[model samples]
Target: MSTKTLGIALLGVGPGSEPHLQSLATLADSVDLRWALARSNPDKARAAVPPSTRVTADLQEILADPLVEAVIVATPAYTHLEIAAAALAAGKHTLVEKPLDVTLARAEELVGRATAHGVHLGVVLQHRFRPGAQRLKQLLDSGALGAVQSAVLQVPWWRSQEGYYAKAGRGTLARDGGGVLLTQAIHAIDLFRSLVRVRAVVASQIATTAIHTMETEDFASALLTLGNGAPGVLVATTAMYPGRAEVLELVCRHATATLEGGTLRVQYHDGRSEAVEGEAKSGSGDSIMDFSPDAHIALHRDFFGAVAEGRPPTVTGEEALATHRLIEQIVRQGKERAA
Candidate 1:
């Protein structure tokens, strides 16, 4: 293990920034959060962190700092590419919030730039770190679950206009790129894809329901095929009132596993079964900060180790882009069918 502590900074101090802030606190030994950039509320951001840390509105200042070795892009989806590219260009090991960015092309550009700069890039798809998800992944890899013959991904979270979508650029295509799929379901989608490769989106539907006045879809549903020639159905919507824990179910040849929150319930056909739990509080409800910070802590720890040891993080930008590719196809194909 690399013993050197990483010097890190956070770009943007807003909704998505809190989880990382919480994580950095837990990872103070391996990571040092030396700076923050809060364009809207510098005072609030400053008060949240240690008095020794600097909070500013200037991106250039953070970029020019020799001590700031890495930056977490907690900015909005549309702003990810611009901010992360600058950090990568400055040779900082960059980690951006999920969905990579607002679009696939831009996500590709950002990942390519990181590669060109010879720096590390990671995405905050923390669901992959959940204990249950990790165990399920290990089982699949070891063939304990057999082949995934079918799967189901559901993120039936809830958010009201006042609680979520009403914010400026909250559900706007210009800022968020899309609604439920991009903003909320991306984590589940990333984890789902990790568990089983989605060969294609066989069919899909994307629409904005009467729940909000957003410019993007609040509901998205799709039928997908797995790489193993199986099938899966994915339904993600924030319109589900009084949201429940998201679920990922994979029906393998030998057994079926249901992952809800941090708990994984597995049942084998031969009368064997088990339920394992891990850190599982995700903002599956009205507030986006409803989740636990342990996953973020784990993510940051791995990222710092990756940076120190000259290796890829647990969820690399390139690996994240694959999720974006599937998301783009879902949105595109769904919109086409809607048209």
Candidate 2:
């Protein structure tokens, strides 16, 4: 393993930035959390960041710092491309929070820029780092599950009207990118796609509830065809009451596996069954802040290790663009059907 300590900067001081902050704090040996840039009020920035870290309003301050080897763009979705591109151009390894960008074209452009700059570009799809997810992936890779026949993914998460959507840019198309599917369920979506290659998607979306007035859909369901000729269904929504655990069920020729919350259950054709408990916590149902930071810590560890070893991170910018492309397809097909 490489043994280099990297200096990092974090952009954006919002709630989304919290997990990154918390994760980086534990890696004092591998990383130095150098600076923070928050476009919000100075008071809020000060309160959100560590006392030892310098807080700035200008993005240039971070880019100009020679000691800053990497940057984490935790800003709004719309700002991802600009900030991440700038960081890559400045010779910093860049890691942007999920959804990569609102559109596939911009996400692809960011990936291209990173390649030209020879810098590492990572995306925060932390679900891939979860213990249960790791075990499931190993089983699939080992061919123990045989030929996968079908899969089902459900993200029945909840966000209160007053607590979530009422925020300035919570559900706005210009900032958050898209509702339910993009903002809330993208983790499960990315995890599912990581395990199975998606060939096509036929989807429908709507913002039917009156809970919060948003410009995007609160619910979406998609019929997917996998590369291996398996059929899959995805149902994602923020309209479900009391939000339940996100679930992904995979059915194979020899065995079937179900991942609910952090638990993994697998049943074989030979009358054998196994259950593995994972790091489960209340999902975004009760509060959007209910998630554990364990995955983030693992993601950061891998990212820093990749940077030190001069290899691509586990979730690269190009790989993340695939998820954004799928999201675009779902939204486009939904619009075409609606029209």
Cα lDDT of all candidates, in order?
Answer: 0.88, 0.85
> What shift in Å separates residue 25 of candidate 1 from its native position after superposition?
0.7
Candidate 2, residues 1-339, lDDT tens digits: the string is 467778899998887888888888788777888899987786888887778789988999889999999999998889998999889999999989988877677778889999999999999999888888888999999999898999999988788888788878878878878888788888888899999979998565555477657888888888999878789998888888877889999999999999987789999999998887886663566466567888999999999888888888999987888888888788878878888
Q: Show pairs that collide, candidate 1.
A: none
Off by over 4 Å in 2: 202-207
**Among all windows of ten consecutive residues in candidate 2, which has the lowest summed lDDT?**
280-289
lDDT of 2 at 328: 78
TM-scores of all candidate predictions against the true structure? 0.97, 0.96
- Strongest candidate by TM-score: 1
Instruction: Give the worst 10-residue stretch by lDDT in candidate 1.
Output: 278-287
TM-score of 2: 0.96
Residues 71-169 of candidate 1 have per-residue lDDT tens digits of 999998999998998899999999999878887889999999998999999999998988888899999999999999899989988889997777777
Candidate 1 ranges with C-alpha deviation above 4 Å:
none
